[model samples]
Target: SRYPNDLARYPNARITFEHNQGIRERRKMRVNGNLLSSYQRQTVCLLGGVLQSEVSGMSLKLESPDKQVVQVIMKKPIEEPLEGLLEVVGEVTAKLAVVCHGYVLFPPGMSQNFDMETYNRLVELMNERKEHYPTMASC
Candidate 1:
């Protein structure tokens, strides 16, 4: 029953199973190959928990592969009320991918809006915490 050798004589079944299976196999191979290539190129960075605020957006720490630590704090001013604050934060976090090896990776049409002062304070804070995580290279 599983083999369905009897259906092999039908042209429609052959087209549905054989031709489609070939396409599916090719697609799977392409997907697996792409995944392998991406794994080889990209370094895995540890994204820490996000600390949210009402005035500003959200603040989260990213530990790069090189052991450097930097906080990816958002610099958006809250113009609207807290109606869709969560949605806004979600959108930002989804699009924002910080590369811990040393920098942030912005998607196409996206630009940096980082708060330098906050980053400086974060650097100081990270330095203070370095006493606990001696292995980490915090900025």
Candidate 2:
């Protein structure tokens, strides 16, 4: 299911568990072709992890095959938070193909806010429709 040959310019765009998870949430309709993104109806779908506060340099930009841009900007990159984000994306890719990848679009250091209640609520919202996942066993 991995389209390794896709040449879409995506910085921090990794089709890892993070990106795949998001893909899972999309709705698969065998239409004649892909949908078009109009300039007025622009929305950036996010499917990636968050960065830690200490790390600098973060960004993510996705251009559609037709050149429509969808970007998700974040600060730093945190593994656990990203793990959580991808899990949510995976659970919902069936209906939303827009959620492509995740990245940071800020300068210097920015707060992760993983501990913030508001952010946690958003994560919860994403994972709300998500299927429960069992923790992987360590070898």
lDDT of 1 at 90: 12
lDDT of 1 at 19: 26
How much lDDT does candidate 2 score? 0.29
Task: List CA RMSD, all candidates.
Answer: 20.8, 16.1
> How many clashing residue pairs appear in each of the predictions shown?
1, 27
Tens-digit lDDT string for candidate 2 (1-139): 2332331332333333343353344432211002322111232233233322223333333332222233333333434323222211111122223332332332112223333345334434433433452221110
Best-fitting candidate, measured by TM-score? Answer: 2
Query: Could you tell me the lDDT of residue 47 within candidate 1?
Result: 24
lDDT tens digits by residue: candidate 1, 1-139: 3223533343222111222233222211111111223323232223222233334534434432223333444443333322110101111122233212221122212112333345445544544564553322111
